[model samples]
Target: MELEQFEHTIRKLFNKELLEELDDDYGFTNKSRGSFKTVGYSTNLSLETIESAAENNVELMVTHHDAWDFIYGLKEECLKKLKEYNISHFWIHGPLDFVEFGTCTSLMNVIGIDRVTKYSIYDNGDVPGVGEFNEPIDFNVLVKRMRDELEEPVRMWKNNEKQVKKVGVLTGAGHSSNYIKMALEDGCDTYITGEATLYTIQYAQFAGINLLVGSHTFTEIYGVESLAKKIQELNTAIKIVKLKEDHFELNH
Candidate 1:
């Protein structure tokens, strides 16, 4: 399918009005592929992900986050590589965070969150991030599920001994004291996010809410994967490949 049609379909799927409201940095960064037979998806536009896309013979690369180092003018090499490989790179950042099958909602589904009962306010609008389980489960059990599903080490700040029924989830760098407070207000006993700061931990402790943290990449990958699946469903002729990377690895 043509890249223009693919991008248009995705924008419609994600809601064009919502994307505009969120001011998302979406659409193609590189437009080398006018038509693509295979597409690649990943959580971020890392060097490894780009290389994997090229290796998999992907003509279009879809990522959740752009190379953030671009702010420091560090993405020239990666951009050059994409141009060299003739791989089109597209990113859908903030819009995917609040979409129906978005980052926060996907994480909630993975961790067994049921009905969404609360929302967290952001620059775009109220995000449906707080929910409840059908039945309360032990905190340790939830931790195990997160580790198994996300395939990342889990960090916990156990502030209460209550079974985790109500939960608030904000994927990818959403662990702020304000979010914790919103969760507490929503009566969520457990709060999950990508990473946490000292102030966030202390706030959760004082507010008596359980805090569970995972790596940013793992927590947000589900959304991009979902997007890829949706795209493939829309265009059966195009193949989709997931470009995986372990951003949490310590070794260079």
Candidate 2:
């Protein structure tokens, strides 16, 4: 498939224009935009890499970063680079996190969780940030189950205290500090996230809520990667590349 054609399809599938409208800036910021060589501090490639990719006729480029950052000068530069290589870029950024059945939903599903509830206070809201299990599970068992199902070790911020019936999950970042009070207000016994900060762990301990950090990239990657797989399955003509990149650093 032609690169632009692939991008067109993806734009339609993701309602890309609507996304752009919702966040005029597309939530672009100066913070790190994943681990791409073109983005990170330790970039190894040069103009020649772009030349080589162009020579290879690479069709599609998937990025973890949003292509709308003011500092990065995204849209023009991205399209220019991709056009030179005859490649089209489909970006999934905040939309990847905000979509109802996107990243957080995928995480809950993988952990056999259900009946997601939402919380919005101080103008902050998300679908998967807060949820409840179908049935109550012991805290220890829940941790073990999450570890086994995600196939990644889990880090606990609080001891196993009470049975977890209602829980909150936020993919990537401690975000616990932002949502912890809201989760508590919503009667959640435990809060789950992909990465946690030291103060967040302390907050969890004091907040009387169980907290778990399951690794940053390990959590958020599930949704986009799954989208890529399903797209590949439906259309044999297009190629899918799951960028093997982890840009965030979370210390356990």
TM-score of each: 0.93, 0.68
Q: What's the C-alpha lDDT at position 229 in model 1?
A: 87
* Alpha carbon RMSD to native, model 2: 7.1
Model 1 worst lDDT window (10 residues): 119-128
Expressed as tens digits, the lDDT of each residue in 1-252 for candidate 2 is 443444454555556554665454232222222212221110111233334444544344444454434546545564566556554444465666666555676677777777767631112444336778778988888788778865677887554467899888777664647567767777889888877777778788888999877876667666666556555654566555444343334343
* Candidate with the greatest lDDT versus the true structure: 1
RMSD of each: 2.0, 7.1
**TM-score, cand. 1:** 0.93
- Scored by CA lDDT, what does every candidate get? 0.83, 0.58
Decoy 2 TM-score against native: 0.68
**Residue 139 shift from truth in candidate 2, angstroms:** 1.8
**Clash list (residue pairs), candidate 1:** none
Ten residues in sequence with the least summed lDDT for candidate 2: 35-44
Q: Relative to the unseen true structure, what is the C-alpha lDDT of residue 110 in candidate 2, on a scale of 0 to 100?
A: 75
